[model samples]
Target: MTRVVIVGGGPGGYEAALVAAQLGAEVCVVDRDGLGGSAVLTDCVPSKTLVATAEVINQVRESGELGVRIGRSAPDSGDVSDVSTDIAKVNARVKALAHNQSEDVGRALQREGVRVVRGSGRMAGPDRVAVTLADGGTEELAADVVLLATGARPRILPDAEPDGERILTWDQVYELDELPERLVVVGSGVTGAEFAGAYNALGSDVVLVSSRDRVLPTEDADAATVIEDVFTRRGMTVLSRSRAERVERRGDGVVVTLTDGRVVEGTHCLLAVGSIPNTADLGLETAGVATDERGFIEVDKVSRTTARGVYAAGDCTGVLMLASVAAMQGRIAMAHALGDAVSPLDLEEVAATVFTAPEIATVGWSQHDLDSGRVQAVGIKLPLTRNPRAKMQGIHDGFIKLMCRPGTGIVVGGVVVAPHASELIHPVSVAVSCRLTVDQLAHAFTVYPSLSGSIAEAARRLHVRGQQAPRKDS
Candidate 1:
């Protein structure tokens, strides 16, 4: 049997191990961290669990609009102080959920008959891996194929290092004993925006510091505008176009200094600057694998590194850097290496979601792409305010946007901004993947008074035979 050794037990590594084993290959996975990497243990899963709790808290806070009451102190009476949560328990639950998922992944791999080594892995060569065992010695595994899936860690500024007390990284936040009284999040990207909205909803006096004109600068413009509006309306202080110079602890609180000679104080600080791939000293040179200047592995669509028998996937490959993308890349890497039918990674068909309040989910081309003449397509947007379910849920923000080819009318891309936009965007993803026309998408069945109905409505509005003419933006 072909021997496959996967380094790093992340979504990329573990998923590749499963496929390799199913293909009747001898597969071994070297895991330094837990089985699911940070995605399960720290990053995506834990953060989303926290976001889920934040959403629940936000719901209780908004129950006043629906004439809901908790005890004698009703929410409609503006008794904000009555709304509180056991944050320590919530965080504990978040960590526990992550832990359970990691355990589940490990069990799945075991069921697949994949050998798992608990250690740090290094590429000894194009066809070998050297694993440093946790307890004592090193074990070198000879392999016909080697897969590198080492993930990334949160980036911290030199001057704003995390003490794990007053300052924290996204991963370390789950360790907090209580919700920060005031949280100053520095960075307005997806990670920053999600956490900012989460903490704000969790009752922290949140101050978002962004070095851009607006939050989620890389997302859909109208979507970002809506998020920023909601943030401010919910009493979040957003300092836009301001860069954080340094973060320092003062007594029980922390202080953030901006380059523009301004300072902000908060109970805690979160550094959402960015991420650095965990590729340093991985013996990539010895293995004949090539990496870019930033140390991300240079891989083809089939996930092959420069080395002959070596492949790389996940954050290390720098392909979108999402957990789902990482898992897909892993499957492709194993498929190509094991001589199975393979399809190359396509960013256009990938769906991405940002877990902020009134979450933003997008797939394929964006509005910027349309406006900048990158692609020719007609688009239409329908607000969720008109949706019966949204009205029942008291959702006033968010919209559904659908885009299609001007002539062929094939659905090319879509964006859904709503509570559970993640769920609403799947059908749109299917349409984009299948190259379905707007008419076909509109004619699909969606339950009445559902948020998904807005997706169909948006597609119908963009339909060639529809009464409404093709418009640019909503």
Candidate 2:
């Protein structure tokens, strides 16, 4: 059997192990952390679960606007202001759900006959992995193929280290016993915007510190603007063009100093600056593997590092830095290394979602690509207010955007900005991946009074020279 050794039991590692084992490879996975890695145990799963709880509260807060009384005695007796979540209980549940998910991944790997080594794995030599066990023991394994999926950790500045209490990292916030009276979030990236919005919805006075002209600088400008507008309308204080220079605990609260010499005080501070890849001391040099100046492993389209028989995936590869992308990269790496028919990774098909109150989802080429003349296409944006379902849901802040080829009208990309936009973006992704024309997409039946209908509507508007595809019923 082909021997495969994978380091780090994140989605990339575990998922690849299953594929390798099923392919008749003897697979062994070495992971120091739990099976599901940070994506499950600390980062993605935990954060989204917290957001789910906040969504319940957010819905109740908006119930009054829909003529639904939330008070106990009188219609005004039980207001949404009375709806409060116990931080401790919510955090406990988050941890429990993350732990259960990790356990499930572990069980799945075991059932696939993949050997999981509980330790930190390092490259001992070419095609070899050395693992340091928890009990001070060491184990070594020879491999026909080696995969590295060691993920990343929250990045902190030298002057702003997380104390795990007053000053916290994204991963450390779950330990809070109570909600902060005021939360000052530094960094306006996806991670920052997500936490900042979540805390704001959870009843904390939130101040979002962004070093850019607006929040979510890398996202579509319109989507970012909508989120920022919502944040401000909901009473969040956004300090644009503000950079956090230092974070320090002051009494029971925390203080953040900006590079421009302004200070912001808050009951707690969250640092979502970014992440540092967990690639240190992995013995990359021993295996002839190489990393870039930023310490991210450089891999080709098939996840191959410089070393033969060696591959890398997940956050370590620095390709998109998304869990789903990491998993896809891992699968591709295994397929190529094992002589299975393999296709190189294509990022254009990947869909991303920002799980905020009014979520934003996107697939294929982005608005930035078209606006900057990177791609020749025509685009259309339809406001969600025009959608009957969105109107019924009282969701006024969102839109459906579609981009198609200028001549043929093939769907090139799309964006959905609304509640559950992630689900709505899937069809757009399919259209882009399959190279379907706008008419083909518009011909697809979408239930009336649904947000998905807007996707079809947006496509119909971009029909090539206004010609519609013949429908089966028509």
Candidate 3:
């Protein structure tokens, strides 16, 4: 039996352990954090759970618009009772849900006959792993193959470090007992935008500082514009082209200084600059496993490292800092290492979602590719405001976009921006992965008066547009 040792208990490490065990390999997982790693314990699960609570608050605020009387109004003053969120209760629930998920992942791995070691793991050699137990003891394990999935942590600026109080990282925000009256989110990326949107919906005055020209600079341009408009309409201050130079505690409040010498003050500041992979101090040099200059472990399509029998995946590999992608990379590495049929990682086919209000989800080629003439494709974008379900739900700030080959009409990619966009993107993901054409997507039946109807509509439009395009000569 092949002896496999996986370092880290994140999605990548844990998923690989299960697959390796199922393939009859003797598997052991060394994890510093509890099972499920940051995804379940702190980052993804916790943040999304908080977003869910915020969504409820937002919906309740829209009750009057829906013709539902929430609280009694005074005849003379015309004042109705206000609805407020209990930050303590919401944080408690987020922690509880995260804990439960971590426990579930642990139990599942145990049932699969994979040993879960509570400790930090380092590569002692190409085929050896040294585990530093939580109790400070050390144990060496022999391995035919070693998988590194150490994951990552929030990246902090040199001049502005998180104090876990006024200044905090995304992982540290769950500990707050009270919501900030004024929250400053310094980063316009997915994490920053998601938190800013969620908090603003939950009744906090938020200021988003973006070094770029707009929020979600990496996402679809139209989607970002909608979200930014929503943010501005909801009284959130968006400071574009502003880079935070430093953050410090200022008399019970937080003050952020921009590179241009402007200062913004808030009750609390959340640093969402990004993340740094946890790849250092893992004996990578001793094992001949190469990493990039930023300390991200370098891995090939099959997750193989520079070392012959070593593999790496997940955030540590910097392939894509997403849980689903990490899990898939882990499975791929295990299959290839254990002599099973495996496919190389195809990043274009992967689906991802931003868990913000009017969530943004995308798969495959983007508009940038088309505009750059990198790929010949026909595309169509249909607004959600045109969808009957969106109208009923009072949603008017999103769209569904489809891209396909001009002649063959093979669906190359898609983008969905609306409530529950994450769920709506799955069919598009399937179409892209299976190389389905726009005609096939358009032919599929979608529920009427549904947000998903827009997806099919976009596909149908793309199909028509594809037919109009001139074919290439053989």
TM-score of each predicted structure versus truth: 0.98, 0.97, 0.96
| CA-only RMSD, every prediction | 1.5, 3.3, 3.2
Candidate 3 structure quality by residue, lDDT tens digits, 1-474: 899999999999999999999999999999898999999998999999999988777666654545555556333332223678899999999999999999999898989999989898888999899988998899999999999999999999998889999899999999999989999999999999999999998788999999999999999888899899988977899999999999999889999999999999999999999999998899999999998989999999999999999999899999899999899999999999999999999999999999888899999999889889999887878888788988887776888888998878999988888888999999999999999988899899999878888888777777655287533111
Over the stretch 221-299, how does candidate 2's per-residue lDDT look in tens digits? 8999999999998889999999999999989999999999999999999999998899999999999999999899999
Error of 3 at 61 (Å): 1.4
Sort the candidates on lDDT, descending order. 1, 2, 3
User: What is the lDDT for 427 in model 2?
Assistant: 95
Scored against the true structure, residue 312 in model 2 reaches a CA lDDT of 95
Candidate 1 local lDDT, 1-474, one digit each (tens):
999999999999999999999999999999998999989999999999999988988877776677777766654464233577688998999988988999999999999999999999998888889999998899999999999999999998988989999899999898888889999999999999999999998889999999999999999998999999999988999999999999999999999999998999999999999899999989999988999998899999999999998999899878798999999999999999999999999989999999999899999999899989899888988888889999998898999999898867899899899999998899999999999998999898889979999888887777776434487555
The Cα local distance difference test for each model comes to 0.91, 0.90, 0.90
- Per-residue lDDT value at 142 in model 3: 96
Judged by whole-model lDDT over C-alpha atoms, candidate 2 comes out at: 0.90
Model 3: lDDT of residue 193: 96
